[model samples]
Target: MYRVIQFSTGNVGREALRMIIARPDLELVGVHAASPAKIGRDAAELCGLGEPTGITATDDLDALVALGADCVVFTAQAETRPDEALAQMCAFLRAGTDVVATSFVWLVNPRSADAWLLDPLREACEEGGSSLYVNGIDPGYSGDTLALAALSLAGSADRVVIQEVFDYADYDDGEFTGVQFGFGLPADAEPALMATPGIVASIWGGSVHLLAEAMGITLDSVSDRWETWVTPTPIDCVMTKVEANCVAAVRFAAEGFRDGRAVIVVEHVNRLTPAAAPDWAYPPEGRDGVHRVLVEGHPGIEINSHVGGGEISETFAGVVSTAARVVNAIAAVRAADPGILGVVDLPAGYAGRVMS
Candidate 1:
């Protein structure tokens, strides 16, 4: 059995652990926690499974590697220091272990990060005969997978556009709430936190290029814009305004082009809508706003799909299910030559199932 070492105890890590537990072929080997509170606890407890799995969270990097794990699923946030995270991935690869992660943006856009870190990783994987890949719900499926799904519907096209409109007003996580919809800090405060180079440009920039390459378009240049404003009043919700730390509305949008020709338009908003009565006319966008993917191309065809657009429970369930699919694709992770890797990299014969 392949031993899977989960590197974080965060929400995404927990979700991945659940999938691993349900899959019969895989074994949960160890849990590595960066926090002291979680250290020495059963991996099952970290995942809220109510029981320990003999595996305990550890902070000793070398000890974690000594466990003879076949692969590691990394979800720990390196925050402003992504290089530290990259170093860990390099170490894992060099130690003869494969890795699947969603930490640094370089996992999606390796060209931007210091090649000093990535080059060694590529070399390590080659020498160690191990595979490495990074994917998640947002950058993993929503942007990449969704884009490829739309392209599958097209024959010949000069350009394809994918748009995802999600209601940030409903997101309640503190880490996300602070930057929901691109709102980094108060409008009047010091330079917005989300306006920094990394948050605004680096985050979605990779997705734009990933989509462009999937369609075989060589992008000449890329530009983006962000807007953040407060709601008329406070929104009281479980995760949206409350947990998301969204006091008002936050919106982030970007447009990509090839040689002055528009190719893709993508936008994300936190708390973009207001509360309304149940029977109120919710309009075409739906009550939770709209999560849609629109493809405009030959003969003017548009395909739009949304999250919570039909069934609210199914929409949330889809996120969890897609996360599981991302974990299952761990075995397919491969090193690339300094460019964006998109859904096209996933082979047509790929079944999108758990790796044995």
Candidate 2:
């Protein structure tokens, strides 16, 4: 079994901890609790195992690094503190720990990643002979891997699209949704970061580029677009209360253009309230928390998949699956060459476990 350390105890990290404990090929060695409230608790208390894991959660980053575990399932909140997360990853790498992460999203396409971001990770990997893979549901497997895998069934290719139809009401972190996402903001006010131009492109753009590269297509430029939906009446959402006529959710896309036309695309129709946008496309199952992949080519393909299943909420499904994507990549990352990598760099039909 490969030794493992779960970094953070938040939504995503909690799920990663649980999986590491369950997998026979993996052993839970340590956990880095970001919140002081969880600092001295047993790893089991945070995950839903109903028992002690013998391993305690701590905030001591240096101590965790010193353990020199085989891999660290890093699910820390990298959106707001990317530099700190990058530094932390480097520390783990310099100490010889492979990293399979859902952070520093820009690294999803490490090849085209900005030098300021990619160089340090590369240097760290070289220094300690470790590897790093950044991933998640949207920018992770849902688009890059799963979408590409479906393309093989197509005889010829025209345009490809991955759309996210998710409800954010179960996100649990209301303040995060209210403040960062501005879920209930008025129409005239400044919208959430999610509504900002280029934000979607910044996050999902890498996935778009990865898809373009995989198909041997060169994109002229990548662009983004967005649309907002409002509530007809006050609605209670995970974020603040949405007043009538206030913005409740958004639909956006990051597209890669070639020959003056969009080709590879990643679109999202997200709502803070379940029925906010009826006109936007949703999963054929008419459920939230689903990702749809469409390949417009010879065989014309389409797929709609949900994570965590019907009994589970969309937020739980999305975050937990993000954790699973990286957790399942542990062994593959360990076997990879010492460098910052992605799903494309690894062998196909061979990830998700050390052994089936």
Candidate 3:
């Protein structure tokens, strides 16, 4: 069994912890908590697993790093603190621990990442002889990996578009839904997170670059476009309330151009409620969400993924899938060559085996 230490217990991190405890091939060695309130708490409690694992959450970084575990599942939020997260990952890597993370989405395709960011990670890998992989559902598997896999059926391709259409009303993250995506704010409020310059490129642009690389084509340039819709009436959801004229829906596209034409595109259509953007794309009947990849070619192909659970909402199921994507890649990452690794570098079929 591979000894594993979990970092943070946020939405994704808690799911990662549940996965670590459930996997027979993985052993939980430690858990790291950023907030003092979480410190000294049992790992099982943090994950809501209803049983004790005897592993307590600690705020001490040095001790967790010194544990010398095989892999550290780093699911800490990176958008708010990219530099700090990068430094923490580097510290763990330099200590000779392989890492699989959902943070640093740009590392989905390391070549597309900034030189400064990539250089230090490369150096850290070389120094510790440990490998690091960054990935998630949209930016990781559903967008890049799955999209690339579907392209194999195409005889000829003109355009590739990967889209994630979600209803955020059921999602519980207030800060993410309201502040980041401008869900509860007015439509005209100073550009929300999705409208920030280069933010879309920084988050989803790597997927565009990854697709272009898979297709063996060079992109002339990358471009982005965004649009927002407001709730015409007051609406309430499990997470937050949206007053009339508040930002309720957003659609954005990040595209990679070849020969002055868009060949690769990553688009997102997120709404607070299903009715908020009735005219926008909707998932299959009875399904809450979908991830789709459309390849415009001689034999155009479209792949749609509908991930839902009986007990949890589709939004939470998406988060669990994101955690599974990274957690399942742990073993492959540990055995891989030392350096910053991308999804393309690892072999196919890292998804964990189902236990009967």
Candidate 4:
């Protein structure tokens, strides 16, 4: 059995924690609760599954590392606290603990990351013989895994595209939806968090390059653009409220070009509500959103899939899958040679225990 450290208590981390405990091959050694209020709580209590797992949650990096787990499932939100996340991961890696994480823009395709950004992690991995893998629904399956798998069956491929069409009404984080994405702002205004120049390319570009690299093609450049729609009148969701004429939906795409022709693309059509972007895309009836993979080749192929069919909501199901993508790979990551590992590096048929 692999000894594991679960970091954070967000939706993703909580799900991963549950997965770790359920798998007989995995043992939960320590938990890192990001929220101070949860620091002293039991692991199961932090994740809200039920009874205690006999493991208490801690926020201290030192305490977590001292437990000497074989791997650390680091699901802390890296979007806002990237520097701190990097430091923590490096600390774990240097302490000889492997890591499997949801997503890290810089490390998704480590080959594309700058020396300054990736070199430290590399050095730590080398010094301590640890490994790191980053993946999730979008950067994980929707693009690198799913899109490439679709293209592999194609006779000949001209283009590959991945899209995430989510109704942010189900996203559930008001500050994230309103402040970071500017969902309730004027159409003329830009999201300070994401609209920074080249940010989209930086975030999704790796997935594009990963597809291209697998197809034996190299991208010359990646370009991006975004558009927004207004609510026309007031609208409300669990996340935030949108006033008349405020932005209610956003559609953005980053295209990777080879020889001046677009070869790979990553796109998102996210709305505050399904009613906000009527023409963009929608989940199948009774669902909240869909991820699409389009491969234009000798025989073009399109695959559209979504989460949530049982008792849970699609958004929450997605959160579960995001955690599962990494959490399920704990065994492969633990056994693999030390250093940074990508989705492509994992062994085939990697999975976790299934409920009976």
Models, CA RMSD each? 4.5, 1.9, 1.2, 1.6
TM-scores for the candidates: 0.82, 0.95, 0.97, 0.95
Candidate 4 at 76: error in angstroms? 0.6
The runs of at least 3 residues in candidate 4 whose Cα sits more than 4 Å from the true structure, single-residue gaps closed, are none
Off by over 4 Å in 3: 352-356
Which tens-of-lDDT digit does each residue in 267-339 have in candidate 4?
9888887789788777677767888898898798998888876788777788899988888888888888999
lDDT of 2 by residue, 1-356 (tens): 89999999887888889899888899999999888899889999989898788999998999999998999999998888878988999999988999999998888888768898888988999999999999888777777877887787788889999988888866787666457656777888877787788888888898888888778889999999988888888888555678888887788899999999999989988787667887877665646677888999998999877777668876778887888888988888988889999788887854556333
lDDT of each: 0.61, 0.84, 0.88, 0.83
lDDT, model 4: 0.83
Clash numbers, per candidate: 13, 0, 0, 0
**Model 1, poorest ten-residue lDDT window?**
276-285
Clashing residue pairs found in predicted model 3: none
Candidate 1: what lDDT? Answer: 0.61
Predicted structure 4, TM vs. truth: 0.95
- lDDT tens digits, residues 1-356, model 3? 89999999999999999989988999999999999999999999999999899999998889999999999999998768978888899899999999999988888888789997899899989999999999989888877778988898899888999989988888999877567777778766787866887788778888898888788889998988888888889989876888898878888888898888888999999888788888998877877788999999979899988777578889999899899989989888987999999988888887656443
lDDT of 1 by residue, 279-311 (tens): 222225334544456666754555554444454
Order the candidates by TM-score, highest first — what do you get? 3, 4, 2, 1
Best by TM-score: 3
Ranking 3 against 4 by TM-score, winner = 3
